[model samples]
Target: MQKIKSIFKTTGTKNGTYSVGLTVIVIAIVVVANLIFGQIPEKYKNIDVSSTKIYDITDTSKELLKNLDQKVTFTVLAEKAGADDRIKTFLSKYSSLSKNIKVEWIDPVLHPSALSEYDTSANTIVVACDDTGKSTTVSFSDIIVMDTSSYYYTGNATESEFDGEGQLTSAVNYVVSDSNKNIYRTTGHGEATLSSSVSELMTKNNYKVNELNLVMDTSIPEECDLLLMYAPSKDLTEDEKTAVEDYLAKGGKVMILLGETSSADLPNIASVMKEYGMETEDGYIADPSRCYQGNYYYIFPELSVSGDMAKGITSQMVLLTNAHGMNLVDPARDTITTSPFMTTSENAYAVTEEAQKQGAYTLGAVAEETISGDSAGKTDADTSENDGESDDAEQEEQKTGRLTVISAGSLIDSQITDTFTQLENTTLFMNAVSSNFDGVQNISIEAKSLGTEYNTVQHAGLFSLLVIFGIPLLILISGFTVWYRRRKA
Candidate 1:
């Protein structure tokens, strides 16, 4: 009986020893981890800093922060309600970019009168110089798009697709640099008025909006940084063409837009557009895939996108229209890269029908094309013209190369916007036009704030679902399995 009791006790002792050993191992691991990671900061606990990625910094934005001399302060006056992880994340990046870039998230809600320090709204940014701590304020919603074109897309202009190039760098330069923006809008030939919603967007950004009457004045204003040509009637006189060419030659930025009128309708203006490798057909575009199936007036469709200015805009377009449009095909060689930044469905095609019936394939349209007008310039003319068809007046038509040709009429005019919102295309076209000019870096950083859709990187709704829920559930399931196995063992 004594031997049996001793054996049982020894067996219990062995079990106890194994348990003690396992506990000791876990404790040792915890101690070592704490030592190596330096007792993880309280704020960063649970957030694996090892998994945090440092965005590849551009030389421009990099050199900016690196060479910064003063103790710079970032006063973010975001309303606490909409203040999000995105702003926080970017703030962290800004911190990483420069030690001088001090970021303070100010809550205007908590202390309503705190805005008096900067004498601005809560949505404004007060960027102070590191040297004297002197500051300048930019709006919280102030946007930037980096594409080199004169025009930048903001507020909800539509495009067919996306490009990953970090155009934000240019906007960063604009924000940090002392350079002021000079945005020019061209008027004549029944263009949309500047006081419209699109023009108001510029005003909100504190840009000086000037209406350019190149037809009347025959010269681009000296203070101009970007020139915009909204949908125009066939009215660019020869003097207007020469003035435009001269402005572009001197590296001045510009934007041009067209409506439904064709080369046939606006012979003088058509000559300019044709020079840019854009040719307008006589009619319109109609497609079941691109049009409202049951509704004859609703023309909702996906346009095409490419780097080609002739493509007009980008794949990021979402335009609403009652009638579709006409387009410009690159009538030039492959050296002219017509970036398919935007495109319609393959089922769509241009229609040559006139005075059409409801059932007939008919909608307004335009396909813009671009070509080299100079070593550093692009023109709209490349499509061949009928030699015998040239008239004395047609011979003097001003030619446009790297020019944006529009085949749609209603989309460009404001009166018809009642049925469609080419406002997206309008913004995009002007942006492209402003960008078409050579050498002037296009600033588009604020474009990131265009919406959460762009912020999501890729169909973010789906990716977010996976990250916010699926991944955590997977981990929980894995933990449960581990616990179950341990109990069984």
Candidate 2:
């Protein structure tokens, strides 16, 4: 009992019982703090500090989640034991974003009946709309996109990029949307086909794309949300042009990509722009200051911040190769409102006789016109044929239509051969398209390459020494100083 009392007695000038109690209290505080933190959601607990934000949810996803009215259930058909950590964390972010989004994990081996209605495999994700009884399935292969170009040449594929956010968001959009937006691409005039990347972007944004030949159909389909004419090699016929103008006059949207007219004449097609007092220049544009790699023909135009086309475009420079210049004949046309959103540098000039002219040239322009009067009753063909008969009241009650014209057709050409340059061009084109349509947000996410990087140390020996010896020595000194002070105390 005496020995026990001595063990528990205060030492020096300190109370041993108080010191023990304080230590116990400090440990208890740490334990309680960790317990509380552990109870928090993984999405809130883990910090995403990756350079590319590989696991972070995008603002586009957050916006969509915020506007969601119906309950969306994301069912993950995978085993919990071998689930992907990144995917699990990414889905958790959606759950925390809104009360309308619910996430669930089901082991396919145990609950096979839950996936009976869905065509899903072991690692698939099914996003279902409870109100509409609609669902979209995303396979595991869709999340990890591979560069398939290698398979065509060498029969091997390397993992290219992560598309989890795009695919998952698309699935969610698909389930919730009442109907997909329909885009009609004009064909039969040698119009260039959309590239694979652009097609993929449309799919990811929940757009249904179809081909329309005006010659065969004689009218734009009623379901067409937007009509795209990309690099038509031949001029549109009078009837086809009239059909297009009629469609536009009825509040339709059209995107026209004009090619260089030096080689080919598209008079009827060019006449479509005449209604808004905008026409394509005769020669190709060359920018000495902003051209790519000192090539004047590959001009990089400046984006206009004041225009709607460049509203959400983050990139300031757009690469346009073999582009023609545009001239606004009447900037103050009473019937139309024109905004030139893209222009070349002041030093930019034409490659032909117009090169000697002095001024910045327009490369992209948007025109909105109110159709009324005799013009309202007349198609483009009728207006071009008969120009002189209209009353004042007929012009008063008019409906508005929009036309977006870009001088460069190569902006959407996949044959450009430069991946980075192509991406920038595609971004600009998609931004313009998105701005023209209502309620259509740009959800195109570029896939990030997982290439390895090598860092070269300037002083390898110094770095090695610091890492091997300096850190440990500093820690040892700190420990010794603490111990020496404690002994003195």
Score every model by TM-score. 0.49, 0.80
- Off-target runs (Cα >4 Å) in candidate 1 are 1-72, 76-100, 104-124, 129-135, 139-172, 178-181, 193-208, 237-242, 245-254, 260-265, 289-349, 352-402, 406-434, 437-489
Model 1, 38-75: lDDT tens digits are 76442243342322122333343565567666566767
What lDDT tens digits, residue by residue, belong to model 2 across residues 278-307? 777777888898988998898879888454
Off by over 4 Å in 2: 9-26, 39-43, 148-156, 260-264, 305-308, 331-333, 353-356, 372-399, 415-418, 421-423, 454-489
Q: Name the TM-score of candidate 1.
A: 0.49
Best by TM-score: 2
lDDT of 2: 0.77
For model 2, give the 10-residue run with minimal summed lDDT. 305-314
Q: Mind sharing the TM-score for model 2?
A: 0.80
